[model samples]
Target: MIASRTHGGGRITVDQRADGSGEALQAIIGDVGDLSVQAAVGDFDLATLLTQVPAPLTALNLDACRMRFHRQLAASLLELETTAVGVKAAAFAYRQAEKGISEAFGGLLDAIGYATGRIIAISLPVIIPVAITIGVQVLVVSKILDVTGLDDVITTHFGIDLGKTKEQAKEALVTAVFEHSDVAGAVIEHVLPGIVVGFVGLPPALLDTDADHAYWPHDSQSMTVWLLAGANQFGLLLPSDVEVWEAEGVTPPHEKPPRDLEDLYLREAACHRGTDSGQVRIEEIVGPDGTTRYIVYVPATTDWSAKSGDNTTDMTTNVQGMAGNDTVMREMVRQAIADAGIDPNDEVMLVGYSQGGITAGSLAADPAFLADVNVTALMTVGSPISDFAIGSDIDVLSIEHEQDLVPDLDGNENPAADNWSTITVDYDPDELRKAPALRDKSDAEIADLFDSAGAAHSSTAYAASIALLLRSGNGSLDRFTAKNSGFFTGDLKKTRDYQGRRKHT
Candidate 1:
């Protein structure tokens, strides 16, 4: 059996119970009850039949048979309904047990996180002094070696040189300390939560200070919330006017709708290749029912530069997106959707990976966007979007890998709602090795590559995991597939590409 937990629709099911089963079972029970009620009141029109027969004894016998049949049918229907209730009750108990265990695990993690943050806060005074002492020791050691000419001697004789100059020596010492210290690694690992804890501990008065009262770029919001919030509040993280235009020389449209999740992911992956290939893919699908629907594919961050430039899908946008702030990436996509001529009444599905996923969630959560488009479904892979309060009417499927730390950046678990489901699979490095970028490498090289964090976040690995889920006969995934069948069965009406760049101020 697949190891998975589904929470939503007011029920929790571990690996044993399939998602949507309780709702389906309850519907059946309701139908059974309705049939039992109908059977109890139903008649065979026997009085009319007797009038035509013109034999009192025969007619009375026929009426008696009808009454018996009606009694038996009603009794049988009631028995069936009772059995369904029992089955439903048993399933509910099992599901509740699973939900309890899952919550326990989540609670444990929450406790640990809070404990760690509190400990760090309480120990900062001691930690700072200890760090200062270590730094002094490193400075003294460097000075001694430099003053005695031992640094040059070691460099010449043993090919061991820490640094030539005093400044370089200090820098080298600090670098060595960080490289060899697990403490440094731990600090980096917990930075996201640490910042949140720090923010949470601030006084209400401090947090309430108006950001507008401060100087531009040094507002109270930035100062109180730290760098990410500050950058956005100060306008440094704001996107330039996104100039979106129709992409030219883009690849031809597919003949049919995406066949599976992997195919959709691959399409999302394509958006990251380069801006010339187009940053967004909008497909107008003519569904089998003659209604038109749209699928918008958004890509991960293409640029990691500190400064926001032409491409709104950059590191700046990543920060803005994760902070749940308005971003140029989102604006570009929104504009593209409008340019595609998708009406407010048209059904739309959004697919995104990484930053794209965050953008998609933001769009789905935005009231303004909802007013402009009928977003029916959203799928996000390797995105930290738990904080987005998307509407329950939208069917949401968030796919994540346990080892991919990106989704954890939000510092919150995805909401457990009936309409929203998160599928988290354990990482397999073998899947990473099959990535196109790694396929041509040697075995040794591939082994080394597995150590990279990016390996776990690979779109290819995500796609491979999705393939396993599709084949795993998991009930939750099947239900999702059935509900969104419109997106997968349609013919590709047309494909449009749009690119945006931040306007230079």
Candidate 2:
């Protein structure tokens, strides 16, 4: 069973619930939903080919082979829904079925049985609560290994190593226990509320389903978040004999206006300019009417949390960064924006990757920040901002790698407001290997995933992704272009800001 939906120009809910009561990965659910449509197309192609066959055929099981191929090809197609349209088409059909299902189901049981045919017509997707997905995984894990043993398995196999001392490894093992436990709790958080109301003879509707605090972790994010969280902790605790001085502040402005949002030259220009110097680069373009448009680019977190992980306060400072830790990053951006002497009246667009995406999102949502700067747009790649309640005025585009788990770390998505749009890209390493420059790096990156955890989180990967979207003529890309066309219209002046880490004794 597969289920997916989009509300009023609204974002797709990406409900993972399939046939029964299990919530599979969102991509799996999407692929399964399109099976029928794809089968029809395949059938058409086969029929067209069969017409060319000679009528006087020798004894052959070629027909059987064709049937087998049909089935096998379908399975392979389902493995990857090559285009966004194919994955999303069934969801659109499902929406239509839902509107019609209510009318058909209103009559008799016999009539309902007749409507069952229409149910098939409705599609193969089912809606299951989140509980089932978690329960199944938990049961499977229990059969294979106890929780404690699993901790050792994950710690030794999954956790990052910057050559930490023995004590640090021991500490990480202890921390892994909770990180692992969050897995089961993540399941409970989803199904428990709806279950409780039903058990108490209350309407399921009584459950507060739309709250900001739902635990909706995607299948891909579970371990990735753990790895990142662990990496931040390790980077902070693993003492280096030599004190490394890392600077954190934006550099003086470098004055070239960006020509196109999709241009790699511009993106590379923004990315290469800020290496190790800071978290964000401020670029300015002077519009015809004398209005300045500031494009503030924030790369993903350089470090997870604070370098010194002495206490729980460390969570607040982790460089992988957190929603609550927005202020720490925001202050740096805020100060940089100020130093750029950006006119309060100038339009601002924030762009970021991963943690920087979250930072970009957090600042855009803040009323105080918006009141001060005319923030007109936000573009984030592989960043999750479901917790943010941003307004409808800003034109927001969230680009996510379909296989990248970093964006789904929050377990929820940005509100489905009309102003907000999301585009999911697939940078599966297998596909990345086709590129010569990426070949060696892709091979060295372990498929064990634990070792190559940064697979889709790189700025380079996001750049490649944006390039794909542009070439594919993605609707979101068109919209993004039309919205920002005005900024590059007049004589352009580019400004750059620098930020970096400061070493402590």
Candidate 3:
């Protein structure tokens, strides 16, 4: 329920612990505006009719009555307009104030972080050698004790299991050092390049900046991968026609668009299951007004194998995605959209989870993809996609769980903008306990269960949290939905399910 301080001019706004109101305030304001418009139209019609009546009507003074009515109608209209404007102005001011305070605070924190990072980056050269020397000494001493049988004697008498203790201590120390400092980043940026090229057989040409730029600039992350894995045309690596095919299975028809974000997330969760379910689901919705909009459901990683061969949704694509490379999975999704008969000009909304979320963001930001596909709205769950530069025109709703590690992988916060809103749900064991399937389990058992399922990153947990936020009537959620209402209404035209593979030779 706690809101993160506004960052980058955006606020992660949601109070899950409280059901503040039954109706979203933004919806109420919209209703008020609609009613005002209707009233104004009715008044115009009545006034026109009234003007036709002579001063000496059949009974009363029509002129006086008309004048009185005119004054009353004008007053009413003004009041209604003022109310709507005031409410909107108040909300805007609140957000501006929040942004101002957050920016100031955030800037201070950034300054501190930069200073600390510089210190750590500089210290790494000195620290790494000392640590290695100490580690070798400890290993030698531990081996000597073990060979002399003093390790077991010490464990029996002094209750000191040196070997087990050192392992645990080493693990903790390494974790702490990496997590709290920029040591790993420093090593990757400055120290590891030469070591990797010499010891790991990496080609120097891959790291060359002047190397022909592919679809995306050969940035640091991409260059690192290229150095290690060797350079290849990303576009050639993924051939859509051969790799992607229609899933050969019957899926339940999409009769209607999802009623809310909760329902949308549930659909995303159900999209990918084992080999039978499709990794990509595209639903074409036809509205009553005959306008067509597409909703693309992209599920999380279905294949976890590190070695890529026939599966596009594998670990290799995940790495490519993180490196800002055009991944096979992204290509597969692009083909799925095109194969579904969706035109480049057709309005599209992409909903994704985990790795699927990253692909969605990347597609939204991709200039080549955007040239063909007009993605107007995007919803991502448990994804670290802050690096992607989504168009300002696109509406983005990112739902992240505080406990989920996936969203933090990007190492940057999602930028705040009018078109983008981030919802961060704090971990609550009570919510987990309320689930019928998990109700019988103890708190500890529930924690273990969530950990196994990727904690809050799991689609089920995201859907549940979204349900709560919906029930609570979040303004951010309402605003996002209101802006992209077309994507949530209309009869289902057809649903296309696509299955993708690597198609290695």
Candidate 4:
């Protein structure tokens, strides 16, 4: 006989007899919540209930509709909230990493390119000969053996004598090939190709990628700036120990004639009398846009001996000498800019010739000037400033003649530290000398000689070249030229007042 037992705890029970006969009973009771089910069956009895029911029991309660099927639902909700916060944090980290990577990679590429370019430039010229030598040796040995018939001779003459010495004879034949006359010719022929290959192939292989990316617009601009400096006489050789200009009483005139047309005519007339008389003063020129421009002058040389006890001539000469002192001139320009209450980083243009050109170039290259002023363009004529280094950030244009030895300087290196983007304008000195008829036979007479000479050496030619450089949009130097003529014209007009004032009085 089979007996069945039913328990009311969200489960069913069954009992089987030995004959395999069994009865199944479903347990169902009213109002038995989760606690009643636990009470009806001990907590340890859940395993039996699960086995008997063969169904997942998340919660055993009367209100089965409200019971959750799995705990993962709640866990997933918590994870979703956490993931939102995590994503924001990750995005921020990624941005920082991206910036860091870009900078690192950019720096690395620049260094590798620079080093590789230098190595190729230096080593390519050296490796060609060595490669040729090796190739020549190989070819020469082959050709010598063919021409001298040394292999056959050695095999026939020494193989039998040595008895089992065919290998030795072959070695002898190979050695004899090097001694043949034809070997030299063959070596030369073979080495030529190797030499060509090494000369042409190695550098390309080493620096092809670097060369493509190594150049920049800034490089040209920088070189021009340095070249302009070098072309000007601004290249000052400072003593290791020096005194500041202020301490030395090295200052410009307090009052002077404006460097305008009337002043120029007056100074020019003074030159007729062989009287070295001129005055240059700085003044503020206001533009239509309300921007103020500083205008300085290149005064005619004057005799300072007539001055009173103050020795105004000496002071003028001293000021002229200061044009060669790059450090002093730079400081003065910086002070002038500061005194004008203008930001040094604002756009600045320098136009000067001869001594004035030297002053401008030196001031542009001064680190302090750079820190304070944003030099947009520099134009110098017959200036010897290109001897100095200019910053890569500035634009510098220079006009020089082949005969103008003043523009030429020593130890000019590539990737110039000062004027990296320097462009030199070459002109015919002979042609320049013929442009304007010579009136007087003095050193100053040569000034007009340049007008016809087409010579880069003359001040007139330099001035014309500067005008051309400023007008032409081509070349890195043009980038620094004034964008508008209004400021320049206004400043030029304002300079007339300081043209011919007597500094000695």
Backbone clashes for every candidate come to 6, 27, 1, 62
lDDT value, residue 140 of candidate 4: 93
Candidate 2 lDDT, 1-505, residue by residue in tens: 1111222234334431221122234456466657756765765586655764775253145556667877876776555544434445555666567646733432222232234434443443442434578889977876565445764575589783323545577756543432343333332233333333333344333333344322321122332333445665666433221111223334434434556655512353354333433345676777777766878876554433544432211223323344233444566677778777888888888887666677778888889888888888887777777667678888888876555555655544456567887776655545444333445664445254322444555666665556545554666566676787665566547555454343344
Choose 1 or 4, whichever is better by lDDT. Answer: 1
Q: Give the TM-score comparing model 4 with the true structure, all chains together.
A: 0.34
Best by TM-score: 1
Give per-residue CA lDDT, model 1, range 368-474, as digits (tens).
98999899999999887876789999999888877666776654568878888888776666665554455687988766655454565767668667776676665
TM-score of each: 0.65, 0.51, 0.61, 0.34
Pairs that collide in candidate 1 are 8-417, 8-418, 9-417, 9-418, 222-230, 310-501
lDDT of 3 by residue, 1-505 (tens): 4332223224434321111221244456567567756755765586666765664363256546656866776686567556656655665676778778855554444334444445556677898899999999988987899899999999999999987997788866654543433333333332333333333333433333433233221233543365425423433223222378888433575688988877788788777755532478888888878989999988677777555567666666677787777877788888998898888888999998888898899999999999999999999988878878888889898988766667766545688786888877775545644644456777687666564424556666676677767765777788878888887887887888888766555
- C-alpha root-mean-square deviation, each candidate: 9.4, 19.4, 11.6, 29.8
| Candidate 3 Cα misplacement greater than 4 A, ranges | 1-242, 249-251, 273-278, 431-445, 451-454
Where is model 4 poorest over a 10-residue stretch in terms of lDDT? Answer: 18-27
Query: Which candidate should be chosen as best, given lDDT against the real structure?
Result: 1
How do all the candidates rank in terms of TM-score, highest first?
1, 3, 2, 4
